[model samples]
Target: MTRRISKTKQFIMMNPIIQFFKFIYLSLKVLVIVAGGHGGTR
Candidate 1:
């Protein structure tokens, strides 16, 4: 778990754009859920 955390930290530091996209994706996911749409595949 610690290794995964460190790897993610390095990934965030190496490419901030990826982080931005990830954040946007998460936000959109939350918005979709809140909007009561097909946000999840379940």
Candidate 2:
């Protein structure tokens, strides 16, 4: 029972860490694309 609970906790922790990085990557990608588009005219 304790092992199962620990495994579940670890899985929960890992998912959020993975998601946070993914969100950061996506946001950076969007910012770069936006900057690239505006940079040429200015």
* Number of the top TM-score candidate: 1
Query: For candidate 1, which ten residues in a row score worst on lDDT?
Result: 1-10
What lDDT does model 2 reach? 0.78
**lDDT by residue (tens digit), candidate 1, 2-39:** 46568768878679788788989999999988897555
* Candidate with maximal lDDT: 1
Instruction: Please state the error at residue 8 of candidate 2 in Å.
Output: 15
* Alpha carbon lDDT of each predicted model: 0.81, 0.78
- Candidate 2, RMSD to the unseen true structure: 9.3
Tens-digit lDDT string for candidate 2 (1-42): 246568676776679788798789989999999887753555
TM-score of decoy 2: 0.49
Which regions of candidate 2 fall more than 4 Å away from where they truly are? 1-14, 38-42
| Model 1 bad stretches (over 4 Å) | 1-14, 37-42
